[model samples]
Target: MDTKDNHSLPSDDTTRLADTNSPTTANPAETTGSTTDPASTTSPTYTGITEEFNTEDIQVVQVGSVLKNRFVLEEMLGRGGMGVVYKAQDMRKVEAMDRDPYIAVKVLSKDFQANPDSFIALQRETKKAQQLAHPNIVTVYDFDRDGPNVFMTMELLQGEPLDHLIRRIRPSALPAQEALSIIEQMSRALAYAHSENIVHSDFKPGNVFLTSKNVVKVVDFGIARAAKDSDRVVEDATIFDPGSLGALTPTYASCEMLEYGTPDPRDDVYGLAVVAYELLAGSHPFSRKPATYARDLGMKAERPKEISKEVWQAISHGLEFERDKRTINATQFLQEMSGPRSGRDSRFPSWAYPVTAAAGLLMAVALVTLMFFGNGDGQPEIVLEETSSLAEEQRTRIEDLLEVAEVHGLVGRYIEPSGSSAYDAYQQVLALHENNKQAWEGLHSLGDQMVVAIQKLLDDGKQDQAEILIARGLEKLPQHEGLQALRESF
Candidate 1:
């Protein structure tokens, strides 16, 4: 099996079975072509999706169908393990004269609804998703019912999911920096959710979305469960656990998840590692084998040739078969990748050095630290020192500019408005503090964001717009190799 299989465990002995694949198989939100929209070119429906849904569902989900008279299903974007996501126009938004009257609505599948606990599962999913407010997590509106059908509304994304992008680039790896940025964003989201005592339970490329603005948004917390150590008070007294439904994509699931062990943050770490590996190496580390099966076979991941030792260590740590051996938590994984690479290079243990040399090295380090932290009194007093030696005024100015750049970035103002754009502000901050960390990161992030937007415009046949943006980007950062290469491709 290509690990394309997804299973659902029944409450009874093969009696009360819940089959999720057929309902969650095809995605309507990911569909670029549409049957109802006369403007969009028609693409073949995703395999086994529409066919499995009974005639009744087909009729219920027909194009132009009105759900609760508030949402109009105009086009199908994708159908997946959770349910069918449609590019729906919120009639309420239209009535309110909203500029972007669109939203992505995921209609629950019949099989999922057929589960005796389906209603409660969906209610939990909606509440859990609403609690996650990070920028990287999708904003879920509300769960509602129109007769027998139930659906959840979310922000309509403009770009393809990570899985689709991986398929397009496969057999060849993504640039190291691009892959790292995507992974970093993913880690941040997972870390945030873990902090809230939530486990994604299903973290796969299919569940990750990269918006046109280059923001990475993680979706589908349908199977999310409270962590084993969660101190959060349970408002709902339901005894049913949604994860018992077992709707996970096997390839990306950790062994602990597969065995139905207690939920842990490390489970997400394992999935993150798998997705991270695929992003950089362009293939699953275990060749699409389930984690348990791979571990039984003693399979080991091969390091990609282009990756640095430090980066590979971080990735490899997350890929560890045992949770104890893994990177400990998502935040540690992110820090390993995002922190300075001072210890990135492989080196022998200090004990490996001659005794005298090792002692001398320790003495030298201690003397340097003492000199740097000399409290003027004859006795030592613990005084925290700023890492940067820049004067307070200079530091304040840099901080102000960096803050301005961040606000601009959040609103997608990467390079417009000339001197006031994120790019220009980052440049100013860098000018004030040559090695300002936020300024450098902002520039790189802005470059990535602009490239994604520019590519989407180019793909849509809006070459004039793409070219204009490209020219503006080059004017700001002419030496940026990513932009330079994009311009040269034309």
Candidate 2:
């Protein structure tokens, strides 16, 4: 949103190709391999070019060049700003096991090799990515070097960047469900990374790989900074700095990130929102030049008339320019996009209400009669005894409900409207003993507790759990305005 000298690069047709392994204008033949010790190496080799190359000189990798005496370079995959990506075979596996094992190897450019600090930073962050194990994220296997050439091995994804797909469907928004499916997977990946204290400072469609098998794999996890670091000097850069590389695409970066160079979990959330907005609206949210804040654009994203209001609301919230006002994390964003539950059309039939009312009146009369006359043994002892037995049964039922309510409070589970929860148990208690003060108080307390629990679950992106709690709360306390409001908010 904000324009700053620190912006990674200006938004252009080439910005999408700036990521690691992304197709770039750099010629593949310009890349050359150098070696670094695997054990002492400390940085990323983002730009594949080395100092050995003059402005007009180009060195091409041989087809059979071996890396670390393990991976054999096969062919160049694609070149990007950082380096040239090559399809390499795991020679150990291929020779020992007689099996073909191909991996994507990104050879650092020479400029990165010349800058030790930037190289070490890239190496450190790439190594950090090794700790993440998620199906939706491209896997980084190892970081090593051949001569002075720095390279990292990772899973070779067979798919196209999401940007290609978006372009193919230009002038038409992707189906809502299809877009949601992709966003959900990305959100899950981000949630996991955030849990590990890793932020994908740079997120865009180009970094999202949609496999032929319908799998979504987010690539270039920590590579954004690697690319940025190789090109610029970061005065006080940390491992987690979004601007550590001094390169952030303004189109996807948050206003605060651009203006202050502070990176947070919210920055990634903002990027995800922009990508999702493009998927749904088939265009950027704003048409004017980039501003310090998205709000400065003074425009709202054009909502696709075909999308449901719930979905549009969720997208709009994610696109908030204010960091604090935006969705706090990926989990919250996912929950909002999930939409509200399609709960039962009706809690009970109209006929059942009338029948229940009639039954209640009959029970009330019977209870009154038993209380007044059941204790007299001389006046129809048999009727008195029968009334006494019924009273005992009612008392036992109330006791059971009370016990269940206590258990439900202890362990939070099956918390649906019709499910077994403290709220439902208390409702049952009140049904039998309308004036039971303990039951009424328990119901009220449970209501309060549920409100907090439901909100938390919603924040954590556990929509199903939140829905269950809300449904059960409403079922138990149909007259609860708080519960009703919670449901409507979804």
lDDT of the candidates, in the order given: 0.64, 0.60
Clashes, model 2: 33
Residue-level error in angstroms, candidate 1, position 282:
1.3
The top-ranked prediction according to TM-score is 1
Q: How many clashes does each candidate structure show, in the order listed?
A: 14, 33
N/CA/C clash count, model 1:
14
Give the per-residue lDDT digits (tens) of candidate 2, residues 183-296: 766876787788778887777675787765555678777766565544446553332233323245566677765664456788889889888888877876664223254467
Global Cα RMSD, each model: 14.6, 17.1
User: How far out, in Å, is residue 190 in model 1?
Assistant: 1.1
User: Which parts of model 1 are misplaced by more than 4 Å?
Assistant: 1-59, 224-246, 340-490
Which whole-number lDDT from 0 to 100 does residue 259 have in model 1?
A: 73
